[model samples]
Target: MLWWGKEMNEWQVLHASDLDFLLENSSSPYDYSGDNNESEYCCGTPPCSQDFTFDRTFLPVLYSLLFILGLLGNGAVAAVLLSQKAALSSTDTFLLHLAVADMLLVLTLPLWAVDAAVQWVFGSGLCKVAGALFNINFYAGALLLACISFDRYLSIVHATQLYRRRPQARVTLTCVTVWGLCLLFALPDFIFLAANHDERLSATHCQYSIQQVGHTARALQLVAGFLLPLLVMAYCYARILAVLLLSRGQRRLRAIRVVVVVVVAFTICWTPYHLVVLVDTLMNMGALARNCSQENHVDVAKSITSGLGYMHCCLNPLLYAFVGVKFRERMWQLLIRLGCPEQREHVRQLSRRDSSWSETTEASYSGL
Candidate 1:
């Protein structure tokens, strides 16, 4: 993973015909290169007023950066959480899953970066596997975020014992169930993504063509993965805010700030990508412009916003570190146990405060 940038360029041995195909139909990776005895094969698709070019060289750099940051941040969160799993809140379980999803997603990015710069050297099986993993993580992360928000809402706003007693079991099952659903949701990618070797380019590439699987998979992705999660998170956070406004406690106020940070960061990072994907879906379904210019814009928008979404993996662990005192406390404990002797005094102080906090109402205590 660390050496991805140097490794990605190792497969750039495009054949002469591949170079010619790239030079001719440079705008699209999906452009077919098979022999067309008839000119009609070239006639129908609209032409762009100007060539839409992207710096493919930048992709490897960008992917490498995301891989590093996301691996570090999420790895820390996962390490801390995993080390002390027996005593974490339900919300942290969702967070752990979120970090896992992001980490796995970023793991596959080097493959994509290489594919973008050159072509898909990996075969059909790998293409399907990568695609399935990507979709699974993408949807799983979004769903996990919603689950976290909802858990927070139940804890803060409703103050329900339903989540407090044996919460670990419930949360564990929830995580497992969600993961299963995500895998099922990802099956379409496994079925749809197959190598369409462009003979002219002398390159094998996985294409997501409508004729392969129709629009059902994409539609489900938009509705179930993107739209539904957004609606659930929005509702959960809104109700949380409404309840917090009426409450008067330092912990509740801190919780309010954490909720705001989580929701706002989520919106900023993911909304644009969903919007672009929605537009692209609509275009593919003939609900939007199908002109070459419009397609180029949508493709560029998806690429840019997708990178922005990738940063969310890095952003999430930062959010937890900055906003969740319990998370930070756990991290501190982990670090202390890992031989941060200088912070032993801090751990003592934390233990002292934990007992005091426990004597208070569970809400106030848990709010910490």
Candidate 2:
């Protein structure tokens, strides 16, 4: 992985046509390549050692914290949403599914944590399952956020009539469609990812078997998982912002804050990772020149940024659900029922204060 000089250039020159073809057909300017699988190869140059000391030290702790925080946050979201006897709003339904997606994503983290600290101890079958689940939920969470944004756009800007009647059915269909798309995106991982021993790393690792398959997977991830959903969110939020701005009130201000916070949080958590991965992808695809130093820099950056990206799963509940008056109220009620009877009056007062902020906002938004 560290040796990227003359031999790497020769390989790039040999595969130049293939790389161009991939770039031409790819959906995003920045695509994902075999960043994860790069350590498996050594150009015909003298064997060079790529240090995984940072990965071993950093990743296990990162994944463990993410798993714990994500599990607790999404678990609370699911529990509160399910406990309610009332019919769910479109936003609520999406939040529930988003929680489920985040939960699924976090559940895979422990296995990955183990993989990072040691080696891929799980066999091939479990590796494939865990990898596929990771990919699916990674995309699903992003797409579901886009769905929430689009739903908000329709309700706030166009005020669509279709959602006014039998909205639950339509929401259900949308969630199903999103999951199906995510499954399709993860299909390559399900088929190709396996636990294999890497000579360079001298450890077993789970990654794509075929380099081309890794390129394809990365392309899909960058395009569909990141870019497509990013576009959808940007457009939806832009329109939602336009409508919110026209209204004159503190509610409008709070709604605007919600829009800003959601977009900013998503961008902050994900953009760096995607950009670093994109560079890795471009190098792998021969779209960019490769050097050992640059590759090593990206290797470390990818680890750091990917950990930041993983943190978004934990942030979802706080950003999308807990910030809302209704959801908070529900959570408080659940807590009170569970064991916080003494705080019931305090919860009611806090709920009433925030609930009065905006009736429409309460119904339309999960968070502010």
Candidate 3:
């Protein structure tokens, strides 16, 4: 199924004119080998994907390393959180889901990395599933960053008792809502992205089919992908920093640094990608410089920035380790439970801090 009946026609006969709006198309028209399947599915010159699909050697290696690191890192984070089970705080709950989302997003990178090295040979089914899954995780991760930041804001900036009241319910509801929105963002992919087989290049690609992409797509992409979460992160971190400033302690200062790092890392990794995509979307809709060089630049930027976005999966686990003292302590305990002797002394030093954090967790997110 094309996921939308009307969108089917565009796939069958995608003239260059139909794709002119999308800077995602290469500066040159996409050319597919002649075949019933190829003609019916993807028909375009490949995007100048070769120019910056990845840095080739280094990127594929990095992607592999990232996949390994992301798996181990996020897995450890999730494992520690799940160990708490019913006793999990709102912060723990958020961290669990964040790890889950990052893991899901990370799982798809191997396929993309393979594509980068050898091109997509997978058929239509994997394409649709992977594309939709990627969209869901990508959007969910972005939204959950906002949700996590808000959860922290409430714990740190608001009254303590008020923050903990039914926190389990609040976290559950927030997660459900975030997944719901992610589904909304993912649905379009089943219709838009599909498998395109080109035996000539010995490659089968998974990409968007040309259709009436313009204002609606641009608006949705802007709001859901870029604007909403950016606002949330900025607002929550700004408030958290402003409030924490009046308090005096190494802990408070550390909290400010963590919050700032969260915002900074997010901006550094995601903002360039979103902005490049946004500019491309605008050009596709005739609202920006629609020149060939400009389109090529946007495409290259999108490719690079997308890699950066994926790198977040690697960064997130480190964030968990660095930002939350409790997380590190818990991780150490988890390691010790698994019989890691090296973490024993480390766990001892963390005890005093852990107790202090536990005591004040009633007042702030120290235990989180």
Best by lDDT: 2
- Superposed by TM-score, candidate 2 places the C-alpha of residue 24 at a distance from the truth, in angstroms, of 34
Give per-residue CA lDDT, model 2, range 1-368, as digits (tens): 11111112223322345556645554533343446734223332433346668878998899889889999999998998888887777777887898899899989988888877788888889988888898899899889878877877777788764466788788888999999998988888778877766654567777776767776777777888888888999998888777766775557557545545766688789888888877887887778977677767877888888888889888867864645556667787889889989879978797678766656565456433
Best candidate, TM-score: 2
Better of 1 and 2 by TM-score: 2
Clashes of each: 1, 0, 5
lDDT of 3 by residue, 1-368 (tens): 11111112223343455555433444434433345635322333233222434345545676788789989999988898887645876666766788898898878878777666666667777877887787788788778778767767776778443336676787788889989988877776766677664333345566655545423544565688668888988898788777777765656656445445765787788877767766766665556645557655765566667778778878877876787677788888888889898999998898775675455542455334
Better of 1 and 3 by TM-score: 1
The lDDT values for all models are 0.68, 0.73, 0.66
TM-scores vs. true structure, each candidate: 0.79, 0.85, 0.78
Report lDDT (Cα) of residue 235, candidate 2. 92
Query: Lowest-lDDT window of 10 residues in candidate 3?
Result: 1-10
Query: Candidate 2: misplaced stretches above 4 Å?
Result: 1-48, 255-260, 320-322, 366-368
In candidate 2 the C-alpha lDDT for residue 120 amounts to: 82
